[model samples]
Structures are given as C-alpha cells and as structure tokens.
Target chain A: MKFMNNVYQVITVAKKEYIDALKNRVFIIFVSFLLILTFVSIIVSSFDFQAKVISYQTALAELQASHQIIQNLTAPEFYPLQLLRGTIEYIEIIGAILAIVLGYLSIAKEKGNNTLQLLFTRPISKIKLFFGKFLGNVLLLTSVSGFMFFGIYLIISLIGKTVITNIEIEKIFLSFIFSIIYLSTFFSISALLALIFKSLSNSLILSFVIWIVFVLVIPQIGDTLDPDNQVPGGLFNKIGITQKSDQLTILKDFSSYEKARDSLEQSSFTKHYERLIFALLGIKDMYNGKTINFIINDKNSDILWLVSAMILSSTLTSIIFTKKKLINK
Target chain B: MNKIFYIAKEEIKILFREKIFFTLLGVFVVMSLISSFLGFMATNTTTSIYNSSVKFLIQKGINNIPPNPMLSFGALTDFRNIIIYMFLIGALLAVVIGHRSFIRERKSGVLPILFSRPISSNTLFFGKALGIGITIFSIILSAFLIGILSSLLLPYRHLLFDDILRLIIFYIFSFFYLLFFGFVGLLFAIKTKSESLALFIPICIWVGISFVLPEIISGQNPTALLNPIAMGQVQVQNSVFFSLMQTYLQPFSIGGQYTSFALQLINNTSQTSLINVILNNLSNITTLFISIIGTSTLCIYSINKNNIGKDEIYE
Candidate 1:
C-alpha cells in the first residue's frame, strides 16, 4: 500500500508538470512553431524554395520518393525514413533548448515561489517529491516526442501518399525514443545546475554554454577534422577512394588523427544520439537499406552511451535537489 | 551624461564579477586562440591523408594520382574554421551578455527602484547600451588579438597585409553582427514575463539565424556546412521561389552572409583591395548596420515601456 501511495504521488506530480507545460503559452507556442516548421519543410519540399531552403536531402528524398529521374542521381531503393533527417537535426538544435528550459523551470519555479520548502513539509519525503518532479519531466518529454512522431507520420502519408511500412514505423519510433533519451540528458544537466546554483540566471547561462559546446561546437569539430570533408564532393571521392575498403586503408596510416577526431565526438552525447538516429533513419549512406536489427546491432554502443548519460545526469540531479540547502532565496 | 557614464562603468564592473560571464569569455578567447591552429591541423591531416591515399593507389597498381588539393591552399586557408566558430560561439556570447545585463536588474527587483531615482528611462537604456557595446567590443577585440597571435603560431606560413586587413574587417563584421544578437537578448529580457522565456526566445532566433536560414538558402543539411568543403557548395536554382527568397529573405540571413563573407575574407584566395571588398559587400554591410540600429531602437523602447515598479513575473 505504501509503495502504491508513493507511485500515486509521483503520478500526481508528473501530471502537474505535463499540464503546467501545456498551460505555459510560450512553451506551447515554441513547441507548435517547431512542429509546424518541421511539417511544412517536409510537406512542401518539392517547390524550388523549399528544395533550396528546407534541405537538399529532403529534395533528394522527394525525387527518390516520387520516382522522378534526375540525371547523376541514382538510388536502388528509396528509404522513406530518411525524410526525418531534417526533423532530427531540428530536434537536436531546437529540441535540446526546449528540454533545457523545461528542466530549468521544473524546479526553478517551485523555488521562486517558495513552495519547495512547504511541499517538503508535507507527508511525502524529499526523495519521493524529487522523483515525482522527474516523472513529470519524463511525461512532458514523452508528449513532445509523441507530437514529433505524428508530424513525421503525417508527412510520409499525406505527402508521400504511401502508408508507412511496419518496419519503417518501428525504426522511426526507436529514433524518437532515443531522441527523448538525448533530450532528457540535456534536461538533467539543466535541472542539476538549476538545483546546485544559488543564482538561477547563472545556472541558465551555464546550461546554454554547455548546450553550445555539445550541440554545435563538438560535432562541428568532429566534421572539420575529417579528411573526407576537404573537397566539394569529398576528398576521398576526389582521389578515387570511393570504396570503404580503400577509404579505411588510407585512414589506417593516420589512425591516431582519426582516433582523436572520433574521441572528440564521443565526449559529447549529441554525437552519440546523432549517430544512432542517423543510422536508424537510414540517412547515412552505408546504413541505408540495412535491416533495423543490423543497424541497432552496429550502433548499440551509441545506445549504451546515450542511455548511460541520461541515467547518470538524472541521478546526479535527484541527489543535488535533495541537498540540505535546497533553496536559499 | 556623467551619470550615464557612471551607470555604464558600474555595469561593466558588475559584468566582470559574474563567474558565468567570465567563464564564457574565457571560452571565446580560448577558441579564438586555437581556431587557426585547428585550421592548420586540418590542412596537415588532409595533405597527409592524400599522400597515404596516393601510396595506397600505387600499391594497387593504379598510377594516375591526382595533384595535391592542398597545393592551392594559402595561409588564409588555415583560418577557415574561424568563420564557423564566430557563428557558433561569438553570437551566443553576445546574447548571454545582453540577457544578463537587464535580467539581473529585473531579477533583483531593482528596476522599479532604479526608476524611482531622478533618472530617465532613456538615460538608463543608453547607459546600459553603451556599457554593453563597450563590453562586446572589448570581447571582440580580445578575440581579434587572440586570432592574430594564433595565426603567428601556424607552422610554415606567413600572413600577408591583406590577410591582416581581412581579419580586421571580419572582426568588425563580427562585432556588429554579435551586437544585433546582444540587442535581441536585451529586448526579450525586458519584454518577456518569464526569465527562461527571455533566454529561450532569443536562442531560438539564434538557431534560426545560425542554422535554419542557411539550410533553407543553401539547401544543404545544416551539419554538412561544418565541413569546410561544403561551405563553397553553390545552391543555384533559377526558379521564381528561389529568386524571391534570395531577393527578400537573403538580406536578413545576416549569419549566412557573415559566413560567406568570412570565408571570402579569411579562407578563399582574393587579392582585392579592402575598399573594393567593402564596396562589393555594401548590401550585407548596410543590412547589418540597419539590423543593429533597429534592434537597439526596439530595445530602448522596450525599456521605456517596461513598468519597472513591478517585479518581473518569472516562472
């Protein structure tokens, strides 16, 4: 009965978080803007402007999907899941900010209103209350992922005029689930900082600083470090290293340089999430047409790293929020 | 005027004491210091990879090896990544500085109290704006020096007079471009009822400016642009929609313009005089100037319109 009561408290708090985020007009507006932009970009990708601005990848997908022939472009089969590559990039950049804001507000508001102390005085223990808040965050994030899923589904069906295959749906579902994990890790980092710091503004600034480093800086460093990125089409392609075997053979001589580049990306969870999502979405050329199981098996370590980051950061957040001096102001 | 200067001086002092601001400033400096070295490394690694690829081809009995791509590269090529770093880090630091400037007074519940004094709202705005302008200038200048010093550290290269002039113009462009974001941060900070929203809205704009607009214009995946090679990929489609977008929205794509201009100035081989370069980019220069002026007007207007007596309804 006691365990059930604890679960009940967690659910109540979780529901409040979900509702609170919904009620916040700014959050709603931003979320809607993000969804609408993603959908519009996917839907109208064939028009010259959309093709030029929305992402050429989407334009390519459109050509491939509609079975239109453009010379110098050839694909044996079209992978519909690849359309969500732009969506994933949006989620990586804008979605991460949304998560950070959600995490900061999850506790910052309670402390700001001076209700945290009062809430702790109630029958529920600090640990349970903290868990409730975390649960609330989880619910809110799941709802966001749900909306993103619908937007992608709407595009594939409405635009492509083809129902998603079960396997395609499954791959997309897994991709979004990983997105939640990626976003939740950022949320935990924001919440942990908001909990630990006395100055909420300072905490928020630091969160953004961390966000820029991971989302923009590190991934970019990894890209610029790649020798293949040196030419217009690709440096390797320029030199007839079209085959993976040839590419790897050449890279073997510069193993340490390659390792350093990989290590830089590995240090940031965004890269792990991106690699996993890109593979699942078949956005990566090598991963296209590969089976879901094969892709997952190949990218399992990314899954592990992503999940571990979410768990570790969340644990740290919970521990920090329960400190003796939870809120000074 | 004396009082405004006093307010500006105090603003600078307080900004220096903020640990988060200092830490970010340090990051901007460090990134500026290493940007050229990283570019140099990118060239070295690519050349080395090319050499190995040639050797591998000879081993496979394939003899028609391509000439070295890096042969065409100038010392200016080593500074390519600075364009990206400016887009990624430089604009963001500006936003933070702007947000922190006003958010602090509002958060401390002191804005109303400041208004109660014998000071005009416009006076306060200018004071703060001047302080912010100087602060941003100082940061940009420091980054400029760091960039030059790092270039000096590049192995086996000499930066010519035009290279130095281009770097100067690039930093000048960066200062104004970043200042626009600074004003964006200030305007939202004053207008928004919630602290997080104040920050969130501006960052969303940053994302749009930095990544989204360029993606739309270039039709490249946002990530693909990070690869220096993709920077030069032309997205030329002569269609009504594409032409319309280029005509109207392209001017507002200041970040995209900045990136292209930065690459031209820093990375690409151009021997034009500084005057011609400036004249050629008159559209972008005017757009940036207009944007900064417009944003600062709105920022000051928001401050005057703000009811300083009431505490901010922060979430």
Candidate 2:
C-alpha cells in the first residue's frame, strides 16, 4: 500500500507538471520554435546531401582515371573517425549549454517563485516530487528530439538522399543515447546547484560554468596532464632483441647438417632440458616494437549504459540534499 | 525620454537587487581573467614555435603568405566561433535575468502596489527589461574587453586596433542578440506567471535552433560560400559534407577524368588543375538575419500585448 501510494504520488505530481507546462504560453512558443527549426534544418541538410553526392561521384571518377595513369598511386586517406569525433564534440558542446540552462532554470525558477514550497507541502514525499519533475523534463526533451528526428527523416525523403543508411541510423542512435546520458548528468548537477544556490540565475551560471569545465576544459586538462606512453624504439622502429637473439641462437646451434643431426640425436636429460629452455626462449617478434593494444570487444554496450546508471545514482544523492530544510536556509 | 529613462533606471535597480546577477558578474569576471591569461600564455608558446618555422621557411627561400593578423589573438579564423559562443552566453544570461525580472516583483507582492501608482504597465515592462539588459550588456562587454586586453599584452603581441574594434562590434551584437531574447523572456515571465517556464522556454529555443533542429535537418554540414573554381556561389560544398564552415569546406576534387574502353571511369588527376579559393560569406549573414528578426519579432509582439498587472499565481 505504501509503495502504491508513493508511485501514485509521483505520477500525480508528474501529471500536474505536464499539464501546467502544457498550459504555459512560453512552453508553446518553445515547442513551435523547435518544430520550425527542425523543419528548416531538414531542408538545409537535403541541399547539403545533394551537393555531397555530386562531389563524391566526381571524386570517385577522378580517382579511377588517375589509377590508369599511375598504377602504384594510392587513394587519399579519409579520416572518418576524426570527422565523427569532431561532429560529436561539436554537438555535445551545444547540447551541454542547453541542458544546463534548462535544468537549472526549471528548479531555480520554481524555488524563486515559492511554488516549490507549495508543491512540497503536498501529501507526496520529496523523492516523488523530484522524480516527477525529472520525468516531466524528460518528456519535454523527448518531444524536442522526436521533432528533430522526424524533420530529418522528412528532409532525407524529400531529397531522395540515401545518406542516412542503417549505419548512419546506428551512429545517430548511439550519439543520442550519449547525449541523454550527458543531459541527465547535467540535470542532476543543476538540481543539486539549485538546491544549494536558492536562485535560478546563480544556479544557471554555476551549472554553465561546470558544464564548460566538463565539456571543454577537463578534456584539455586530461590531454595535457597525461604523459604519452612512448615506446623505447619509437613508433616506426622495428628493432627487436628477441628476434635478434633467436636468430643468432638458431644460427649458432645449427651451423651444419651433421651438427644439427648430432644435437637432435642427443636424448640425454641435459639435452632435453636445453631443448626445453631454447623452446621457451624462442619467441617470434613479427610485429617487432609495436605496442600490444587491448581493445574492448565486448558484445554488449552495457558499460556505456552503466555510466548513465551511475549518473542517476549521483542524482539520487541530490534528493538527500533536497530533503534538507530549504526554508530554513 | 524621461519615461524610457525611468523604466531603464527601475530595471537596472531591480537587477542590482537580484543576488544572482551580482554573483554571475563576479564569477564571469574571474573566469574571463583566467581564460584570458591561460589563452595568452598558450598562444605565446605556439607563436614562438611558429616563428621559428617561418624563419626556417624563409631561409629555404620559400615564402609562405604571412600568418593571418588575428592569429596572435586567437581571433583570426576562430572569431566566427567566438562570436557564436558569445552570442549564446549573452542570450542565456538575458533569459535568466528576464525570467526572474517581472516575475519576482509579482511573487513578492510588489506589482499590485506599483500598478496602483502612476506607473503605466508599458513603463514597468520597459523598466524591467532595461534593467536586466543593462546588466547582461555590462557583463558581456567586460568579459570581451578583458579577453581582448589579455590577448593584446601576451608575449607574442599581435593584437591590432582593428582586432579590438572587431571584438567590440562582436560584443555589441552579442548583447543585441541577448536583449532580443531578454525581451522574449520578459514576455514569458509575465504571461506564464511561472518563472520556470520562462527559463526553460529560452533554453529549448536555443537548443532546438542550434543543435537538434540543425543536426536533424542538415546534419553538421554548413552551406559553402562558393564553387571550387571561384566562378560562382553554391548551396553546398561539393567535397566536404557536414563539416563546420572553414577554409577547407570547398570541394577538393580537381577537374578532368579518364575512362577505359570498358566504360570504367578513372580519376585522372594528371590533367587536373589548381583552382582559386572560392567561398561565399553571405550564409553567415543570412543566419544572423534570421536570428535577429525572428527573436526580435517575438520580443516586440509579446511585450506590446503583455498584461503586466496579472496575478502571480496563475499556474
């Protein structure tokens, strides 16, 4: 019965928030703005797609023709990873500002207007109220994201462009998931700040500063502070002690066919031990000085998701802070 | 004139009363100083390395075009990006200020008392917006000046008078953009009677316009300024798709190709010739136009019809 009541309270609060937000003229304008922006983006992106296709076709033809003239000429290297990384970084920076602003303002404004106290005075527990607000914000976020996706789809269909293939869809999905994780993290941070600062504007600025530190400053700091793992022989060097030793030992041991035969015929305990030692020591160094890399080839993206869950735990910590007496502060 | 000044003065005073406004200004000042110092130090180190490279090139009788003048200040090519960031910060600051400006007065039960006086609703609205706008403008200007001054006094020293003027112009536009949204925020705060909506509304607009909307419709690809051969303008770059607008956004494809007897096309770069840099600077102007006109229209309309004396507890 207690669990049901808790769930019920959370749902009721969420419903009220949703209804109130829907009735807000500001919310309506923002929704309209989102829809309009999505529409415009689609048209613009389609034009870009058409241009890319033409360029790609021309480049491919040029490459093939050049291959006939210079048989050994290799195609220029393309940096898809760099491009993907840059795009994701660019979008993340933009999204962080939006998330921080929204998250801080949502709680800060409520507190500023004293509506938060009224909302808290309800029969519901603080946890329920927190969750309800969070859920409501999530819904708003989803609506905006959905509008953007739909607009993009329409644009691709209108342009008859096949740029958004299955691979592109998957990449988009991953990027969106990463964005949501970051968004939730920002929300948690903002909520905590709102509770601590008591003013929307302060919370907004503080959250923004934190966001900048995390999104821009931290990565740069990480790069500069971490020492590069330089190899002894350098990147291109192929000198190998094991290879040299193995070659020398093999050459010395098998200098002649008769010597080799004599060595093979020796079945004594010492000969067996020697052979064992040699076999243990004789390792190939095909890659020479190349560093052994450990790649995470896990079948599941569970770790990435676990990060989001961990962030949620941090958000739960803010509830403890929220449960503290705000009026007294 | 007195009425406008009266409104502006009232607005400014109210903003001063808000603790957050002062805190933000203080923090912004500190951050500006830190970023400026760090940026200057980092750029100086890089400039020395580049100077040596220039000397080496000259010694080899290879004269490259002089480094762009604004490079010393990180304002050469990155000025566009800096402007965008400044505009975003300005808009956000305005929204936060606007969100609470009129709403706070009503929440404090002062609006009714103020309304009972000889003050008109328009004056009240104007006053509230002006106050917040002034504060936002001050913070942005101060931050830009600090950043510029720090950049100028760096060890490498390449800051020109033109750079400072350009930055000032950029800062002005930044405030203008923010003021446009600040007024809209004023409308939201007044009409919704829910400060939460005011803050959330502007954020959603910013996100939608800058990220979600742009990414969905056009991906990351910006429109090219001109065709590769510098002949004419094009809607998009032929080579790079979804790249941020930069010098490299043009099509890299050298013209001319060879075809085999079997009708297989091969890239024949042997016959390809170098082309001059062709780009259009108009797309950026178009973007500015859209943002200015769209946001201003909403602000002007909302303020014009706003019911400033409404009860505070609407939600």
Candidate 3:
C-alpha cells in the first residue's frame, strides 16, 4: 500500500514535470535543433557520398582514357546507414548540452521560484520527487530519441532511397537506448549540481565547466597521449607501424603511455558512450557491415561502462536530493 | 575617459571575484602549459628517434643520412595543439565574459542604476568593451607566459628571437579571434530576453562557426576541421559545389584562418620569408580584421539601442 502510494505520488509529479518541460522554450529550441540537425546530417552526408562517387568516376575515366590497366578502382559502396555518423557527433555535443540545460532548468527553476518548499509540503518524499523528475525526463528523452530514430529511418528509406535491414533497425534502436543512458548521466549530474549550489547561475556555470572537461578536455587528453590521435591517420600508420602484430610490438615499448592514456579515457563517460555508439553505428570502417551481435560483443566493456555511469550518477542524485536540505542555502 | 576607466576597472574587479571566471582562467593556463610541454616532449622524442636511426645506419656503414624533419621549425607545429584548444574553448570563455558584461548586470538589477548615470551609452559600451578586452588579453597573456616558461624549461631546442616573435604574433591573432567571439556574445546578450538563451544562442553560433562549417567544408577529413596544419596537407578534388561552399564559408571561418595563420608562423613550412607568407595569406588576414571590426560595430550598436529599463529580464 505504501509502495503504491509512493508510485502514485511519483506519477503525479512526473506528469507535472513533463508538461512544464514541454512548455519550455529552451527545451523546445534544443529539440528543434536536434531534429533539424538530424535532417541536415542526412542531406550533407548524401552530398558527400555523391561527391566521392563523382571523384572516383572521374579518376576511373582518366585511367581508361590513358588505356592504363586499372587496379583498385572499385566503386565506393553506399551505406545509407553511414549517414547516422554526423548525427552521433551532433548528439555528443548538442544532445549532451540539451540534457544539461533540461536538468539544470528542471531543478533551478523550482529552486528559484521557491516552489521546492511548497512541493516539500506535499506527501511525496524527497526521493519520490527526485525519481519523478528523473522519470519524466527519461520519458521525454525517450520520446526525443524515438523521434530521432524514426526520422532517420524515414529519411534513409524514403528520401535517400535505401532500405535498412530489420537487424540494422534493431541496432539503431539499441544505440538510442544507450544514448538515453549516456545522456541521463549528464542530466543526473546537472540536476545534482543544481540542488547543491545556492545560486542557480553558479550551478549552470559549474555544469558547463564540467561539461567542457568531460566533453572536450578528457577525450582530447587521451587523444594526445595516444600518438595515433596526433595525426590524420593513426601515428603508428604514419610511422610504418601498419600490421596489427607490428603495432602491438611497438605499443609494448610504450605500455606505460598506453596505460596512462587508457586511464584518462576511462574517467570520461563520453569516451565510453562514443566507443559504444561508434561501433554500433559503424563509424569506424572496421565495424562497418558487421552484425549487431558482433559489434555488441566487441564493445561489451564500453556498454557496461555507460550503464554503470547512468546508474551511478542517478543513484547519487537520488541520495543527495533525499539527504540534503535543498532549500537552506 | 576617466569614467570609462572607472567602469572598466570595476568590471575587471567583478570578473576576478566570480568563481566561474577564475576557474576558466585556471583551466586555460593549465591547458596552455600542457600544450607547450607536449610540444617540447614531441620535439625531444623526434630528436631522439633521429639520433638512434642515424646511429643504426652508421653501424650498418651507410654514409649519407637524410635530414631530420624534427630539426626544422616545422617541429614547432606540435604547439599547433594550443591553437586547436584555444579555438575549441576560447568562444565558450568569451561567452562567459560577455554574459558577465551585459546579461549579469540585467539579472542583478544594476543595469537600471547604470542607465541613470551621467555617462553616455557610448561611454558605457566602450568601458565594457575595454574591460572585457583587457580581461581576455590578461587571460591569454597568462597562458602565453606559462607556455613560454614551460617551453624554455625543456632544453630540446634553442629558442630563437625569431621564434619568440612568431609566438607573440600568434597570440595576438588569438586575442583578436577570441575578442571577436566576445563581442558576438555581448551582441547576443544585449539582444536576448532570456539570460540562458543569451548564452545558448552564442554557443550555438560558436558550434556552427567552429565545428559545423568546417565539417561540411572538409568532409571525410575531421582533422582538417580543427587543425589548419592538417588542412594544409589535404588535397581536395575541385568541384563547383565545393568551390561555392568554400567561398561562402571562408569569411565565417575565423577559427580556421587563425589556425592557418598561427601554423604558418610557427611551422614556416613554406620555407619563405615571414612577410611573403603574410602577404600570400592577405585574404585570410583581412577576413579576421574585418570580422573583428564588424562584430565590434554590431556590439556597440546593440548596446546603444538596448534600453536597460525597457528590456524584459527573464531570470
């Protein structure tokens, strides 16, 4: 009976939160940006494909005109699914920012308006309130992701004139699910910070600083440590360390550096999220055309990291929200 | 002039007091130091690699050794990472400075008080601009000082007067590039009703200018999007569509031009006189100059047009 009552309270609060978010102009703008960028990515990627094909054809024509024996002149394969590459990058940057803004606004608005005190006067426990907000946000994020995936599906099939496999659809769906978890980590952190900081603006500023560290600094640090990230191709490739065995042999010489780089990468949830999504979406050529099972199996650790981050951040948020005197600055 | 200086001084004081600004300043300094150290390490590693290779060739009785690429000024291109970091983080920092200049005043209910003062709108605008300009310059200068010190500590390469001059020029370009964004943020802050929206809109523009435009222009080559040195290495097959896009996008790509100009100075890969390199890239230089001037003019206009008492404050 108590559990049922708590659930009822949570649902009521969640519905209110959902309605408020829907009415928010900032939220609306972010969603619009995401959707618009999704379409733009598809269009831009298609043009990119066309350009590559044209360049290849031109090269082939030149070779034939000279009557030269042609080798390695195969036409580029058009992977309609590859159009999702830009979408992932957009999500990494814009989607993460949206999550941060939504999370910040959700708590900061309540705090700023002195509504938290009124809300506390209700029968709902603080945990229930926090859960309600989290659930509402999760639902909202889910809908956004659902719309994103469906739009990509429609654009790829209808506009791009390419058919996606059922399995490919499933993989895309799974990637979005992971994205939700990844994004929720940011949301939970922002919400937690909003609850902690006295000034709402300070909370928002700190959130952005944290965002820069995780989104830009940490990953780039890892990239810098790995000589491969210094150049266009992997540095190893540039230095004639091409073969897998040869690369490993050389890596052994710099195992300490590799270990340090790995640790730095491990600290960032973005790295985990990127690793999983990049594999699932075949952003890297090695993962291209691979089955979802194969990709997931290869990236099991990254998936685990992302899930752990989501769970850890949300749990921490709930605990902090319940234990802290949120109204007393 | 005295009133402007007073306002500017007060602005600087408030900026230093803000924890967010202080934190960003610290991060920028640390990043600069790290970038310079990394450049030093890269140079050292390359030198060692060349030495070992030469030793091995001598043992094999090979007489002629290829010149080490690391010995040239091109090796200083490792410091190009600093330019990339500045491009990525500079605009965001400027947004903060810009917000503090205009939006925060409105939020704190200080704008109305300022508006009632005897000072004209032009003076107020100039004062705020001057304050922001000095603050940004100081932050960059701090980073420059740290970078130079860190680089000097590493004895891998002898520091030349010419190299020091080039570094100073690069930072100057960086200052203008960052100032342009600061003015842009100020422009948006004055225009927008919502404080968060003011911040968000400028950042969105930053994203477009720094990331999206470059990505579109340099398709299939992500490195070129951030690193002008990498862009220099890219060989784009000519297409009318691409040409049109490049022409349209070039003016907006202040970050790219900054990167290119800085890399050209530090790397000197063209192996030409500095004046010739500057002359050859006159168009890029002019674009940066025009952008700074244009954005400053717009920012001033926005400040003048905005009525502190009339504007809605969305807190």
Pairs of residues at least 3 apart in sequence or in different chains that clash in candidate 1: A53-B216, B112-B308
Chain B TM-scores, listed for every candidate in order, come to 0.92, 0.64, 0.90
For residues B124-143, write the lDDT of model 3, one tens digit per residue: 87898899999989988987
Runs off by more than 4 Å, candidate 2 = A1-49, A59-180, A197-322, A326-329, B34-42, B45-84, B121-133, B173-175, B208-235, B238-304, B311-315
Q: Could you tell me every candidate's TM-score relative to the true structure?
A: 0.93, 0.58, 0.92
* Model 1 residue A317 lDDT score: 88
Model 3 ranges off by over 4 Å: A72-75, A229-242, B43-75, B220-224, B227-237, B310-312
lDDT for model 1, on a 0 to 1 scale? 0.81
lDDT of 2 by residue, B202-226 (tens): 6665554434433332244221100
Q: Which ten residues in a row have the lowest lDDT in candidate 2 chain B?
A: B254-263
User: What fraction of native interface contacts does model 1 preserve?
Assistant: 0.54
Summing lDDT over every window of 10 consecutive residues in candidate 3 chain A, give the lowest-scoring window: A232-241
lDDT of 3 at A66: 97
- Best-fitting candidate, measured by lDDT? 1
Q: Fill in the DockQ of model 2.
A: 0.08
Over all chains combined, what TM-score does candidate 2 have? 0.58
TM-score of chain A of each: 0.89, 0.58, 0.93
**lDDT tens digits, residues A65-169, model 3?**
999867968888887777788888788778888898889888877876788888878777888888899999988888888899889999898887787888888
- Candidate 2 structure quality by residue, lDDT tens digits, A111-175: 65577677657776667777877777666555555555545554544544444545445434444
